[model samples]
Every structure is written in C-alpha cells, then in structure tokens.
Target: MLNKTLVPQSVARKIQGMIQTGEFQSGDKIPSQREFSQQLGVSRASLREALLTLETLGLLETETGRGTFVVGGKPSSSSHMASWRYSDSYSAFDVFQTRIMLEGRITSLAAGRLAASQLDQMENLTQQMEECWARQDLLSNVEADLEFHAIIASSCSNAMLRSLYQMVREQISETQRHPIPITEPARMRASIAEHRRIIAALRAHDGLLAQREMENHILNTARCAGLAP
Candidate 1:
C-alpha cells in the first residue's frame, strides 16, 4: 500500500522498486488503475501519471486491452543493448501484441482526420525509407519509419491515444536502434508495399479499411520479428 500523500513520482519510484526487488515479476499483470488508486489512497490521475511515466521509462508496459505489466528488466550498460534491454524481459512479441491493438485503433481514428499535408508527410517518409533501404542505411530507414507512425498518431484527435503512441513509439525506437535481421532488403521492400496500402486506405477515408491495413502491417512486422504466429 502507498501513502495517501505520496506523489506520483514517488509512487513511480516505489513501483520501480517493487520490480527491482522481485515483488512484481516480468509479465505479471498488476492491479488495475482504479484498484491501485484505492490501495494507495491516491487520486486516479496521480496514479495514471505515475504509470505513464514508468511506461515511458520502459520499466512497465500497458497493453491496450490488458492491464499494465512489469517489463522485466532494467537498462543495460552496453551502448548497443541499453535501448532495448526492456525487450529481454517482456519480449518483442509483447510490444507487437500491444502495438497491433493501439495502432489499429489509432489508424481508424486518423483515417478521416488526416490533413492533406499530413498525407504528404507520410508519403515523404515512405520515400525516405525507400532511399534508406536502397543505400542499406538502417538508421535513416528507422528514422523515417518512426516519423511515418508519429504522423498518423498526430492526425488522431484523441490526446490520450497520442500520448500512448508517443510512449510506444519510444519503445519501438529502442527496438529499431539496432538493425533487425528479419528486416532485410526484401522485407523492407514488403514493408513499403504495406505502407502504400495503409496510405491508400487513409486517402479513401475508410476507417475500417485503414484499421485493417494498419493491423496487417503491424502483424506482418511482428511475424518478421518472430513475435507472432
């Protein structure tokens, strides 16, 4: 139980301590926001903020449908490993599992909301990815990849969804910081094709179609990462 006067940052640290001490193991679903709020005698808003802060720090993961879970590990010392150390705990599949849910919904919301300039931006990012792929520039490809997703997120009218996307995108960035073997030339090309389909769906302002296409794209990426069936 937490103190009634505990601030969110303090709550966050306490939660982190719990994970570090093995009180909460990786993949273990924690109490619901409401439950935690009551137990801590803290306002839900404070608790939510603390949770989101932990999420952004890569210490916990909040699945779209499922509740939050301890992400399993801390950042590593190795420069190349530090970014994605959280993956070792919950696994890449966990990230994709959540992404499929969040991105699919956000894409639907963004379908009818995207501006012409936003569409142009997505298209530009796609083109940049193509050039990066051609040059075997994984870093540039990753940058464009994140920007394309961020644009879709920004197009959505939901602030909560946008914040969630920002956090998830950060985690995705960690995963992308290193070149994934599964995303070789052929797969990168396939990703571009998938991006084109998603763009087409958005252009048509078909929310359902956009959602399906985005889900398909994410699922394919998850499969490539060996995180999906």
Candidate 2:
C-alpha cells in the first residue's frame, strides 16, 4: 500500500501524467502555483513540494522570469533534490554573491553604530534561532536568520543600501532552502555560530573584523549551498 504521507508524490505523478499525455508539452509553462493548487484542490505548499521533485527529475526547469517549463521526459529516480523556490530572475549563486558583497560592507558600517535596542533585538532573534534549531524547526530558524541580517542592514546607516538589499530579500530567503547541504544539523549549528561571531564583532565595534566575519560567513554559506567554490 502507498504511504498516506506521499501527497506531494501523488501530485507529481498527476503532473507527470499531464506531461506524458501532451497536455503540457515540452517548453510549455506549467500553471502557476495558485492555479495548480486551485485546479488540483491541494495546498500551495504541497504543489511547491511537487514542483521541486519535478525539477530534480528534469521533467521541469525553472527559468529566469519565464516561470516553470515542461521538459517532457521520464522522471529520474537518482536525480538530485534541491529547492525550486528560488527567484526565476536570478540563480541562487547570483543572489548570494551579491549578498556577500553588500552585506559584508553593511556589517562593517553597522559596527559601533548599532543602538542598544538593535543589539538587544539581534540577541533575542539569535536566541530564538538557537531554540528553533534545537527543536528541529528549520522554517522558523530561517525567518530569524533573515531578521538578523535585516537588522544589520537597518543599522548600516545607508538608506540606499538597505533599499537595494530589501529588493533581493526574497531571493535571499530561497538560498536557505533544501539540497544546499546547510540544512543539515551540523551546518545549521555552524551557521548559528557564525551569527554569534558577527554579533561579537559588532559588540566590539571592530568594523574590519565584523566585515571579515560577515564575508566569511556568507562564503561558507555559499559553499554549503553548492553555489560557490
């Protein structure tokens, strides 16, 4: 008997059938998540999960600003799994590379300038992240991770830089998703530790060290995500 928990797989097979039957031919853009979920009577989360599987099977390819496209091929059981939630306009590598450049400088500028409230907020968020990690709750952890960086962006004293970073924030969130290898517990703990290091540098008012720490953290993250050397 099939497992009751295989909801996404069931959705995947249905979409696969549509591909096989030529309803969604090669090079065709599949329906949007909202449309698919509505048509299939399933949640958007489940549909997204199914699309990630299809992307791994090479039955679909997500393109920049082009939506998800059908490749019309058999699903490969051995294909690697990764998040398909990234921005279509920018690859994960592109987003993180930009982040490393911007955030490293931002952290440097924020050093010695952060208000007590800001530091307290960051400390609270970091604690929340650690607690979430202990509970194995990745989603909440990712939220706190984003918030921590956002606070640093706010502290940078550069309104334009903050605006630019905000523009790509969603793309940044995508990099935290699965198949990047950082989702593993050890890597997640390492990430939390890196956060602490950045915090320490900020507390010390050491601009250069803060910048270096932020850069190193981002580089390590990119490496774990398979986006950088």
For model 2, residues 1-229, the per-residue Cα lDDT tens digits are 2432267767877887787678998889988899989999888988897787567545677887979988654322223444545546777778788878999998999999998788888888889988976754334565678789989998887888888888877576556544322245677678789988999999999999999999999888888666682
Candidate 2: stretches off by over 4 Å: 1-81, 178-182
Cα error, candidate 2, residue 205 (Å): 1.3
Q: How many clashing residue pairs appear in each of the predictions shown?
A: 0, 1
The candidate maximizing lDDT is 2
Error of 2 at 173 (Å): 1.6
How much lDDT does each candidate structure score? Answer: 0.72, 0.75
**Per-prediction TM-score to the true structure, in the order listed:** 0.61, 0.64
Model 2, residue 165: C-alpha shift (Å): 0.5
> Which residue pairs show backbone clashes in model 2?
64-88
lDDT of 1 at 48: 86
lDDT of 1 by residue, 1-229 (tens): 2443247757776777777688898789989889988987878888886776566445667778987887653432111212244655666667777888888999999998998888988999999989975754444566688888888988887889988988777566544432243355677788899898899999999999999998988888776555572
